[model samples]
Target chain A: MTAAPHPGRTRRTVVLAALLALLAVAMLAGVGLGAVPVGPADIVRAIGRALAGEARVPGDAVIVDIRLPRVVLAALVGACLASAGVLYQALFRNPLADPYILGMSAGAGLGAVIALTLTASATALRFGVVPAGAFLGAVLTIVFVVRLASLRGALDVTSLLLAGVAISYVLSAMTSFVMVFFRESMTSVVFWMMGGLTAASWPYVWMVTPMLLAGIAVPLLSTRELNLMLLGEDRAAELGVDVERFKRVILAAGAVLVAAAVAVSGLIGFVGLMTPHMVRLALGPDHRVLLPASALGGAVVMVLADLVARTVLAPVEIPVGIVTALVGGPFFVWLLVRRNGHR
Target chain B: MSVRLAYEAATVGYPGVEVVSSARLRVAAGEVVGLIGPNGAGKSTLLRAVTGSARISDGEVTLSGRSLAGLTPRERARRVGVVPQQVSATFSFTAREFVLMGRHPHLGRLQQLSAADTSLAEEVMARTDTLRLAEEPVDTLSGGDLQRLALAQALAQEPEVLLLDEATSHLDLNHRMQVLDLVRELADAGMAVLAVFHDLDLAARYSDRLAVVAGGALGEAAPPPAVLTAGMLSEVFRVRAVVGADPVTGAVSVTPVLREEAVPAAGLGSVLVIGGSGTAAALMRRLHLAGYAVSAGALNRGDVDQAVAAALGLEHVALPAFGEVDPRAEAAVARMAATADAVVVADVPFGRANLGNLRALAEVAPRVVFADGFRGERDFSGGEAARLAEGLAAAGALSVPGDIDSVLAALERFTAR
Candidate 1:
């Protein structure tokens, strides 16, 4: 154990480099593999003209207007989901904890259903109503759960999980009621709940990007504080950490990021839970490196999962959530089996 | 020379609960004070209060006339270093890294370590002899090693006052002596070191002053000789003992009295226990507890077994420091064994010291030696016992067995008249 170049740090840097390369390749592949297949040379020419302000190629408009925005949005949302996952893991100290583990997705889904009902009567729900409603729902659910768990002036992870479970059931029930009540918007509500990039657009990306960046940055800065906290709240206090204040700040920032990602992408499962844990196994528990590594890893996992969802069946796209859940469920099972076997 | 730390009618405990109420005591610098008491006497709590970890309910804890509340944790670290009893590491840091963390208070947030700070840490490690295990994980080290590591870490901070709770309970004889020597050395170097020790002999040996904490308050703190008295030990520890000193070093060693156990009378045998101080206490207790009529001579007072004989009201002939064994003491041992069936000698250290006493006892009775005598180990009193055993065995009057159990087993085989 000759201290392997701060193994965690080295692994993280290598993983980050590999992820950047993967993202570049995925961007190229995403542009070239559609029904009207565009060659890389032609796409390169189109991209150059777009950069040089001289685009008049025949199919250039479709490629730039249609395909590029969707792929770009896929990458952005993928990065957002992954970064949110890392933040949630640090806040919960549980490798299995993700943003939706707190029931935010169920809350957001219920909000989307309500927005669909409002849009039936008026079109005010068109531009930002869906994401805005989802964001509000997520924030409200987080506040409720946090308040419920902070009854004794100290927050406990178990109580928070229990509160999240309770709210998730409540919201899921309400979402089902809206689904049955408005069968006309059943297709749209169903797609939103299953999670997809079918509605991915430049405007949606702009709306969620700021919240996502802030969310990632805030958790990254608090990485040192998080390291102290892994020893438990009381011990952390003895070492000069103001635990209550730190907890409040982390929870609020983590909630904002989770809410924004949920608002835009609906409920993309596993991206948040799986990426952070995989990073931790390679990186050790120092949040300083763990947080940034998780963010990069999460982005890579989400982007790849989205690629498979869009291309595996080609013309007929699969719901991105189905692919993630299929992957994450078995990964989680293996983790549990290995952990129990060791014990 | 005098730095005072004390409690003035102070009550201390957790939030809204008082474990120790109205404790009063004054501990002066340059005086190594000990706090001893029964369990739940709030001794640990008092230590916490002094370190500003626990809140004082009523009065304040002051150091050199300044309230402890006025000092920041960094200021306290600079002046007072505390070694908590239940020390555990959450993360596996190397011994050196753990020690370096003690230097946190001295350095500012962005300040790089100066050469002086680095050298100070090295010096403390060398002084504590923990530098050899500097790169080993704190979790993997043995108890003695961990204790030394803890002391080194506390010393690295270079504090003026050191507070240790049960620091030496895990050490062996050599380590105990080593740690105590370091404590005294530090104290002599003008750092006030207050340590808690369970070993009565150790506390009496190194501490200039001892204070007992019992019933949630501090008892009288005074010099070891004055504090570790016979009456005080009997009252404090709930055991009877004759308190005396080692003739070689003048350090206090107690002889405890064991309660007598009723045994059926067997053949009469006069047994002489020839063993060093405390080792004989267990044998004497076992012998007396079995209800065998027993007597011993040249046995030191304050030895645990001497106290056992006194408590059992046995016929014990003891040697006094003030005078030699008179005609009556020797004559009494002979008279008591005149009609006895057998004689057993324990593994007593034959000192150039106790040679005459051994010679006197060998003159009478069929001597049964404790088996350890023939092992030919280094003799405490030269080779007198080894030579005497040969002569007595040649005469067919002495028998040697392996251990305490074997000697007692052989004694039971001889039928009483």
Candidate 2:
């Protein structure tokens, strides 16, 4: 309780400060930068004018209406993906695992594809299509993963990963087959497949932010259990962490986050895989630090990618997925090289 | 602070195979209970069952007359703490964090650490001599250090009853003694401790009561001298041995008698064995099976391996350990070694405190062979065995491989010799 410079508390303080600063910059840049090139002052003015019931800024209204929702949605999706990544990595006690390693994304994608195919004929279901499909897919995948992994008395991570990978590949192949069969709906499906925030609206932001916050907060509270799990399941159980129930809860929570993200913007890769690891390298392997940092770091990466996606061609657009792949691939290459050399 | 633990009609094992059945065990508070058994005796299974990590199958465990079945996890944890057989951490949590986990059962759901709980954890860590490691990662701990850390974690729980299953198996002699001393101190403080031990002498010296489990049944559950007798050991452990009180500590001491296989089928050569305890049993078994006429001496009859040699009807010359050597027994050993094709000395203990046995072996054998003891520590009597081994090696005696398989291979090499 003394305000003395304790090393542990000081380090946590420094890390929290740095993460806040990064998030602030990411938010500002996401609001200000776009093909229309609104400056930070005008962006602020437009937000204030809209709040003050004056709906007139030369091109500022377009930025708020179009780009702001997409940017906000990207941040929500990114935070969800990264925090879900943190949970899965800690739950399995494997550094290489990610949010989608549980098959939630592929299952969600398959469900979305089926919905799209069904909705093409029944045009009345246009608004209900993607989110409904994603939720159903996530719930189904979690059930399958849990059932397959349960052997003897408890669920195991190694078996869960194997089952997840098998189900994911099967679902992916089926999705590809469906895409080929319904070539007439190819453009709309391809847009979802490309992982863009183009369709993001204010209503979507309201839906996702609360879900992402819950995903982040729940896992943060259970950081100690995740730490115990790293000692192996039997040891964890001996130490009073209900190892079986913890696994079920974490898997369910991770699925909900990933399914919710895919519900808005189809599968976005690398954020889930890279952000937790990057945080671990910086903050050390404690889940209390790693989980929140992953959420903030994922938002930063996604927002930056969104800015480039909207502005790189200036009035011409590239899908945000292309920008994420472009940035994340080289970043991942450097990470792998540095990690390999370090070992 | 007295910890009374009881297990009644406890049946434990895998899904179908019951290893321990209907075993009733009771230990009064502040008593150090030792559970000793042979390799497959289900001692560990009973410990796990009591800890509630393993299912009870059909029985009940009670701490202080409270049924363990009815207690919540947190409630049970407050009464009992468990130290498992092996400690491994796949993630590197700082030692402080690791020990703090012991306070889990004491904390309410979603409750952060209270100031009192943190202080209790630190106090326990210091008492366990694990405070030095508080900031260090648990994964980076050495085996001894890790065991102590594990002890700290259990102690931090501040439970009334402590259960350790072979906790000292990975420790060295010094650390093992230190850890056992700590257990005694904890029991003195009025905590109940039920520990499973492998070393018989350590069990006898420290434990208030010893529980010997063998062949899936309780052999003896009494004070040391009564439980660790020669007859009980031979019947349960299948090794013939003498049991007596230690001169220094007044605790039970064991010396194995030689029990070889039957006399050689082809009489390839005569083997003169100068060894004691386990090394002699192994040497007797290997040499006799390899078709050698066996004769052994410089050991007492109550020594378990000597009984083994007697059972195989080997030409044995035994001597009593209490008084001066018998001149006739000495003469028989000399004659046996002189007539033999090879003389094999197993990794037997020889204290400078007792030099007559080594001098007699040295005088009789033209070729002296020795096997390495565990980790080459040379048992409790260190310098004397090494110097004797050095002399034998200089005199062109073969130093057989230290491990069991290698010992058999060395006998095959001797077949050609």
Highest TM-score against the true fold, candidate? 2
Candidate 2: where is the Cα deviation over 4 Å?
A1-14, A119-129, A142-166, A181-184, A313-316, A325-343, B1-3, B50-52, B213-220, B229-244, B255-417
Global Cα lDDT for candidate 2: 0.75
TM-score for chain B of each model, two decimals: 0.69, 0.68
lDDT of 1 by residue, B42-108 (tens): 7778877776567798998877667887876556666776665655553445676567656655656
Q: Rate the local accuracy (lDDT) of all candidates.
A: 0.68, 0.75
**Largest DockQ belongs to which candidate?**
2
Error of 1 at A38 (Å): 5.5
Error of 1 at A195 (Å): 3.8
Off by over 4 Å in 1: A1-190, A231-235, A341-343, B1-12, B15-17, B22-280, B288-319, B322-417
Q: Please give, for residues B240-289, the per-residue lDDT of candidate 2 as tens digits.
A: 55576687998888765533233345877776877766468767766776
The TM-scores, one per candidate, come to: 0.69, 0.78
